[model samples]
Target chain A: MQRDALIGEPMVRLTGVAKRYGGGVIALDTLDLDVMKGEFVALLGPSGSGKTTLLNIIAGMTPPSRGSIHIAGDDMTHLPPSKRNLGMVFQNYALLPHMSVYENVAFPLRVRKLAEKDIVKKVEAVLDLVQLGHAKKRLPRELSGGQQQRVSLARCIVYDPSLILMDEPLGALDKKLREQMQSEIKRLHKTLGTTILYVTHDQEEALSMADRIVLFHQGRIVQQASPADLYFKPRSVFAANFLGASNILSTTAVGDGIAQLKSGETIRIGSGAAVINNEPVMILVRPECLRIERYDETSHLSAANSVPGQIVSSTILGNVTNHHVLIADGHTVMAQELTRRTAHDWVPGEQVKVTWAAADTRALEPDEMDVHS
Target chain B: MKETAASASHSTWITHCANAWAWFGYAFLVLPTLVIIPMSFNSTDELAFPPDSFSLRQYEAFFLKGDWLSSTFLSFKIAIATAVLAVVIGITAAYGLARSSFPGRGAIVLFLLSPMLVPVVVVALGLYLYFATLGFSGSALPIIVGHTLVAIPFVIITASSALRHMERNIESAAMIMGASPFQVFRKVTLPLLRSGIIASALFAFLISFDEVIIAYFVGRAGFSTLPVKMFSTIQWEISPVIAAVATLLTILSTGICILVTIIMDRK
Candidate 1:
């Protein structure tokens, strides 16, 4: 869907960008990235992952200690944030407390020296776009958290900036409001067709909203791909663990597209799985892909892989049920299945067998920390 | 149940005692000042509370007497100039201190606030000697300069807290919205700090208007401030006109304080 929006030259390019503090602490390591025009890219990471620092550098609020930055093919490494012609939405909404909502939205235009009549027209139109037209006279403090966020959105969009940077803009809102704002922002991105670089620590937000997700860990890019690609083909143990819950079984690659788990159980691998001989690897199986059945059952014979385990616990999550199975070598694998009225409920301590297709598993390189452990 | 009731009643009794103590404290601080109002209405030359006859005679002398009105005008002029000068210097210093981190910043702040910690008489004497060395003593300029020095620390304190409490990201947001640094300061920072700057400016004005130590130390015969004139009169004789001047000064300071409070408490 976003392919058409991604055509043309990259809107933002960072070449070997890096940041280091006075105490020799590395906030951001040297990294390169490109963001296409009109494409929404999410820098997704946990805290201290250098996502916010990268956004700040691109916004020209913080200068990179090394490397260069380009915005719309212009070198802007040394330019001040004011000269960048970008807009930013902060987590706290950062609205001018002394100004009314209308004036706050009008601030960028007023700085640009637009005619008063034109400012009024533009401000009203943008306020209406954000569904905040009636709140023109209210101060930011007078508005609810969601309303304040909308006003901030209005303020940033009123200037028609070429790019927008959002630093966890929905972080402070409740879950329902955050979901609503997520779709609202998606609609705005579609309507405006402007590039956006969003920084967030929320995996679900990045998965649902962004055209592409750039996963960061320890000041480096762990993986950069479509949400589905990252989920299905995680390149490392960290990548597999970060995106979602995965049953990672430490294994040693054997010959003939097979790997032996630590418990000495063998599993079939997909034909595309590139496994080096006698190398330590990890097999990632998502919870939703696993099938759980009674241990005595002869079913799932064609599934290509099965592991015997005891049911540790089962949790009902409204639409789906999660069953935690304790396999050999103290490895626990979670299996999720959609709740069905006719399905048998497995209780704790019940022996079960879990099965999955070879195609559903990803063979990944063990992370350095995991290898040491 | 009995113990709980006794404890609740004990807390209520403590609250009533604290309230009465607070009211008594306020009266102790305010009643002596309020007494000047009635004394200013004395009909005779003697200054007295509850005058035998109510009259504006003291006020008449205050407005018509030698150098009384002139000195008041001089005080206003000096105080306004000091307020403007002090606010400009103080807010700039406050912004610099709040926004940047550099070596020796703490020392710089200590130097700026040193005027407040030092005795006013020492500061006045230092300024008096410095100006005498420069051959600039005994002029209205010296008095204005002296008052600004003392008033600047209060302005810095007020403006610094405002800057500290302000949302720092608004400045960055404005910058990314295509506002130049100077434009951001003018359009965003200044307007956001409007109340704090105004309150501090009024504080500067009040400090300069009421300042007698520095004014007397540096004032010329032709440029005597109202407080300095009042100081001289009280030292020389007990005049009823001084009572009227004191009442006016009290009213002016109180009005400015109320204005400052209102500005600070506004949303």
Candidate 2:
């Protein structure tokens, strides 16, 4: 398959889109999003985060309560879904149970009143593209979950729509099948060069498949950036915890570039840290960034902050070992170390030191805890 | 080991007793219909069970009599019209009731199904009084309209149940793929609902065909339906032809019920 080299013009543009249901339940707050042609963007969020609602608005299935939508530079705010010329793949595949696979794939063309010959050719090509050519005569119930999803994909793309919206399309599949379909979808997106807006709650899926990830929280967009950028530098505490596992410690800024932990240890912050003196902040350290060593062996290490703690628990997870250590102030911090053939195993209640460079840690403003008094 | 064997034998005996009771229940329900079938074939003119001889004379009489045949034909026509009207109105009502949320949705559903909950004679009397004021008591329109009113509830029940089972996203998928609302209904919703609609139409036809109380009150002059005709005949005289008609109706209604059961099971 030949790839489209040039990134095309803007494919979808949403300005101040809002969706308020009856009784004043806000499914989507005022939000703006843009997708360049051929770009694969993933809406990543938990349930009730409005990612699915956002997708529905973009597909024109649900009218936005307020704001405007432009598709391919044409204002489509009031247009019905049929006028938008977009394809959507639902989570359950939603294959028409009464129709044969061939008819299901030919439905869009038939609705458009295309020539019969052209419909057959296009349907056949797309079915072959999804590798379901041999199953054309079978009904949806006769196929496996993965095959059903592929047929759904084939049906959506048969008309060569300018954009495709998929709402957790691989959610129903098992792990191995989900991974296979993810790669298959990515390959198809590359070859077809059609922009796609995917919605999923799985952070790993978004990280692996999307060109950019838009993180949503409670009906608002928290952050939108490339996967690597979001992973390495999350703008908010929610983004940091949601994207990956993080060990957060409550600390108070005591100096120009240092913070005092509750354990009374002063640690120098990295230049990249976003905090000021005398302000309460949360220090975030990735589990894998923390190294476990003996308390006495850390003296030779320079330019690294060390915390003395006791190993409370250790779990071996195939390629790495995760250890939970309790520090002086009764806070538990997690440290993950790669499992090598000759790696030493630390027993419970053994004294240990956790060390990491200042560059590996981040100090940011603390989030308001929503605790009930 | 002894206790297990003893309990197993006890359970087997219980199963045999249960099976015997089930067979007795079925016989109690169906034995009357079986008697009518044999009486329809009796060589004698009077109604009797276990006839000594058999003949098709009553079947021939049922087909050859002008009043009987015409009344049968009229009933079929009214039933077919009622079926079409009920299905058309019922589908839209079911769609609205199933897909949308409003303040009085539950109350609206209860009102639509009120005809079924009320006694059939009460509904029949109400229709008679209402149509009499309009000077339509003696016309076929009253019977057809009354039958449609009763049949609409069944159609709504069947269609709404089917709608509940359907995945709501299929319609949305069709719409997103550039199908207009009408096209989505035609190509997606209606096709998926074909069996349900057909079954409901069959129910409407059967309900109209067999309904006698409303037919008795509304049907007058020359517009009496088959059931009304049969009722009047049985009132003043005894005929084996009525037996034949009953047998035929029994078979038809049974076949339709079986078909509905099969369709429901398939889904």
TM-score of each model, paired residue for residue: 0.94, 0.93
Can you give the DockQ of every candidate in the order shown? 0.77, 0.83
Pairs of residues clashing in candidate 2: none
Over the stretch A1-373, how does candidate 2's per-residue lDDT look in tens digits?
Answer: 0113436557888999999998999999898888888889999999999999999898887889999999999999999999999999888999989999999999989989999999989998999999999999999999999999999999988988878999999999999999999999999999998789999999999999998899998888887888987887776678889998888878888987788888898776774356777888788888998888997894555678788899999999999889999986689999998878798888999998888888877875443431110
What does the lDDT read for residue A352 in candidate 2? 87
**Can you list the residue pairs that collide in candidate 1?**
none
* Candidate 1, residue A202: how far the Cα is off, in Å: 1.1
lDDT of 2 at B26: 100
Candidate 2's residue-wise lDDT over B1-267, tens digit each?
A: 999999999999999999999999999999988889989999898998788789998999999865999999999999999999999999999998888889999999999998999999999999889888888744589999999999999999999989999999988888888889999988889988888999999999999999999999878789889999999999988998989999999998999899988987887
- Residues B87-133, candidate 1: write the lDDT tens digits: 99999999999999999999999999999999999999998898878
Decoy 1 TM-score against native: 0.94
True contacts kept of 1: 0.96
